[model samples]
Target: MGDFQPEAHVKGSWGLNFIALICKRSSAVFFAVSLLKSIAQMYKVFVNDKPIIFTTSFKNEEDFPVYIYKNTIIQELIYKLKVGKLNGFYIYSNNLIEDWKDFKVKFKVIIAAGGLVLNGSKKVLFIYRGNKWDLPKGRVEEGENLMEAAIREVEEECGIEKLIINKELLITYHLFIQQNEYRLKETHWYLMFSNYEGSLTPQLEEGITKAEFKNKKETIEALQNTFANIVMVYESYLDNID
Candidate 1:
C-alpha cells in the first residue's frame, strides 16, 4: 500500500540476497491479487457532478486522486465535496466490501429501472424531465424484475409500445435529498429497440415536457444540459452498440 515497488527480474546471489528477493516477490504477488479482487467490485457513486469511487486498484487515469480508506473519513470527504473543496476522490481499500458498507449505510437506497431506446431509424429516445434531458426510467414496483420494470417504465413514461429490450446496460447511482433525508437512487438501464414511429407522448403528471427521438447530432447536443448519470448511461449505450 506504500509507494509501489515493481518486482525486478534480475538474477541475484543465493546466499546473501535470497531472502530479500523472496520478500519482494511476495509483496508483488499480494498487490496483484488485491488489485484483481478489487477490480471485480469497483463502484462509482455520483454526488451531483462529482464521483466517489470505491476500489483498491488505482486504475483510472482520471484527475481524481486515490485516498487510502483506512486513513480517511467518509463524512469529512462528503462535507468537503459539498463546500467545493474537492472535485472528486477515490476511496481505496483492501477490504473493499466493508468500506462500501460503511458508505452505503449512510443513505436510503431506492431501486429503479429505465432504458435507452433506439428506433428503426437508429435514433435514440429521450425525455425532458426536471428541466434536464434524461432517458425514460422510473422506480421499481412490487412483483417485477429489473427488465420488466425497465420496459414498463419506458412505455408508461414515453407512451411508446412494442418496446423490446436488446440487452442489459449498466447501473448508475446518484444521491438526492427527499423529506429531509438523504436518498440514493440506483437505476438499472437497458438497451432497448422499438419500431413504433407513431406520435411521442410525454407523461404530463411526471413533469416530462418532451419525449422525442433524436439523431446522432441532436443527441450530442442534448447531452450538454443533462445530468452526469444520464450521460453515463448514454455513453454506455454507445459503447455497447459500437
Candidate 2:
C-alpha cells in the first residue's frame, strides 16, 4: 500500500502553561498541578482530529471514552479507528512512560521537523500536495537537530530564504502506512518569520504542486482542507502570540 495518513485537538504548551498558572493559585492546587504535568508529558497520537492519549491521569473530559492501558488490546483500538467507531479515546495507566514505550513499539517511528512560516504581511506559507493543503515539512536528516531541519526543509521545499525560527510551537504525531507496515511520524513544528519577497517555487519532485502565502481569511479557508496536526500548530502559534 502507498503512504496513507489518517490525521490534533491539543493547544500545545501555552495552553498547558495557562492551566498550570490557574492551578497553582487554587486551594486544592497540588493535585491539579500533578495532573497537568502527567498529561503534558503523555503520549497523544492524533488520527485526523481524534486523539489517542496514553496517560497515567484519568481524563474526566467526557468527550472521549477511556480504557485501562493494561486491559486494552492495541489492535482493537486500531480497528475501531479504521472503521470510524471512535472519535477519540484514552488509555489510562499508572506507568505512563513504560506504557508509551510498549505502545509505540507496535509501529515504526519516524522523526520530522516543519515550520509555520509567516512573511511581513503576516501571511502564512502553504503547499498543495496530494490534493490537500499542507505546510512544508520532511523527515529529519542524520546529525541535524530539529531546528536546523525545520529551517532547511522550509527553505528547500518553498525555495525561500531569510527565515528565522521564533520558537518551537509543538510536537505532533500522526500514523500512516507504507509497504503494508504502520509508521508513526513525530513532527516538531516551529513558528518562523521571513522577509524574502522572492518567487515561491514548489518542489515538484516532492509532489508539491504550488507554494504561496495566504492572508488570515485565506488561511482559514485553506485549513478546511489541511491536516489536523497543522491546525494544532496554528492554534499553538496563536497561543504564543496571545
Candidate 3:
C-alpha cells in the first residue's frame, strides 16, 4: 500500500455493528460496512460508468439484479464487470474490502482538479455545458501543481481573473471510458474566491455555453440537473457556510 492508509471507523445501529472504510485506490471508494459482532466492509463496483454499492445488508432493488454469493472472489467480480451489460449490479459479501483492494490495481487512473468559485456577492460560479449545470474544472496540466491547475482552469473556463484558491475541499471519484478502456478519475476540489466584475465568457470550444455566478436559490436549482459528485461538493460547501 506504499504510504496509502485506509480511513476506518465504526458506528452502531440498532445493536448491529457498522464499519466504514475509505479506501484510497486509483479512485476513492467509500465502503459502508456491516458486521456480525465483527467489522466488515462492502464493495462498490462501477459498471457502465455507474456505481453499484454492494453490501450484505442490501435487499433486491427493481432496477438492478442482485447476485448473492457466499464466497465471492475478486476474479469473478472483475469478469462480471468486464463482460456484463447491465447498468449495474450488486454483490453481497462480507470480505468486500479485500476484494476491492485487489480489483483497483487493474485500472488506469487520472488525476484532475476543479474549483468551487465564490464571487464578491457571495454567489457561486457555475457553468452550463452539455445541457447540464456544472462547475468549472478540467484535467490538471503537466508541470503544474493541483492548486495552480485548479485556479487556471477556473479562470480559463469562466473568463475570470484574479481568482484565489481559498482552501482545498473534498476529493471525488468517477469512472469513465476513454479509447475503449476503463479509467478512474480522481478529482481534487478546492474552494476559491474571486472579485472580478467584468463580463463572463464561457469557453465555447469546450462546449460551455454560459458561465455565471449564481445565488443560493439558483445554486439549489442547478443542483437538480448536475452530476452526483457536483451535488456532493456543493452540499459540503453549504455545510461549511452553515
Candidate 4:
C-alpha cells in the first residue's frame, strides 16, 4: 500500500463526515459514514457508476436487495463490495472511518474541476450529454490550477466567456472504470457567474449535444434526470444563496 493522501474533503449531503483519498496503484474511491453514535441514515458512494449505499436498517419494502452484516475482515468486505450483485449493503461497525481508510489505499486518484454557472438572469447553465443533463467540467490539465481548469472547461464546453468564479462550492467524488482500470475522480466545484449573452454551443467533440441556460422551472425538470453529484452541487449552491 502506498501513502494515502487527502485528495478532497466532501461535506456529505446527509450530514456525514466524508473524505476522498488517493494512493499510488489503483483507482479506488471510498466514502465511509459513521452511524454508531447516531440515528441510522443512508450514505451513498458511487463505484463504477453504480451507487452503493451504506445504511443500518433494512426496509421491508425496498425494491432492491440489501446485504446485512455485523463485522467482517476489511479485505473480504472490499471483495464482496466489488463483486456483489446487490444494489447496496449495510455493515454494523464502530470503526467505520478506520475501515474505509484501509479500504481506500488500494487505488490511484484523479483530480477534476467543474462549475455551477449562473448567468445574469439567474438561470443556471446545463449541457445535455449521453441523454442526460450535465454541467460543464473536465479533468484538470497539466500546469493549470483547479480554478483555471474549472473556468476553462465551462467556457469551452458551453461556448461562453467572461466566467467569474464567485467562490468555491463543493467537492464531489465518484469511481469510474476507464480502459480496464478502476479510477477515482475528485472534482472540485466552484460557484460561477457569467455575463456572456451569446448563443450557447455545446462542445460536440465532448459528446455534448446541447448547451443552454435553464430557468427555475426548467432546472427543476432537469434535476429530475441529472446525476447525483450534479444535484448535490446545485443544491449546495441553492443553500448558500438562500
Best by lDDT: 2
Tell me the number of clashing residue pairs for each predicted model. Answer: 0, 2, 0, 3
Clashing pairs in 3: none
Question: lDDT per residue, candidate 4, 1-242, as tens digits?
Answer: 12322222334444322211111111121222222112244334564433444444433324333444334443354445568653334544344445445445555678889999999999999999999898999999999999999999998999999899998876776666678765767788899998899898899999999999999888867765666677667766865784
Per-residue CA lDDT of model 1 for 158-242, tens digit only, reads 9999999999767787777689776888888899999997899999999999999999888867766676677667656655765
TM-score result, candidate 3: 0.68
Better of 2 and 4 by lDDT: 2
Instruction: Spell out the clash pairs found in candidate 2.
Output: 7-47, 7-48
Candidate 2 lDDT, 1-242, residue by residue in tens: 11212211344565555444433433223232223234544666766545677765654546567899889997788668767897667788787767877887889899899999999999999999999889999999999988999999999899999999998877778887789876889898899999999999999999999999999888877766666677657766776784
Which is the leading candidate under TM-score? 2
Of models 1 and 3, which has the larger TM-score?
Answer: 1
The root-mean-square deviation over C-alpha atoms between each candidate and the true structure, in angstroms, is 13.3, 8.6, 8.0, 8.8
Tens-place lDDT per residue, model 3, 1-242, is: 02122223333352221111111221211221122112233444344334555455543344455665545453455446566554455666556655445556767867788999999899999999999899988898899888988988998899999898887766666667789876777778899998899999999999999999999778767765666567546654654563
Model 2 has an lDDT value of 0.75
> What TM-score, over all chains together, does every model reach?
0.78, 0.79, 0.68, 0.70
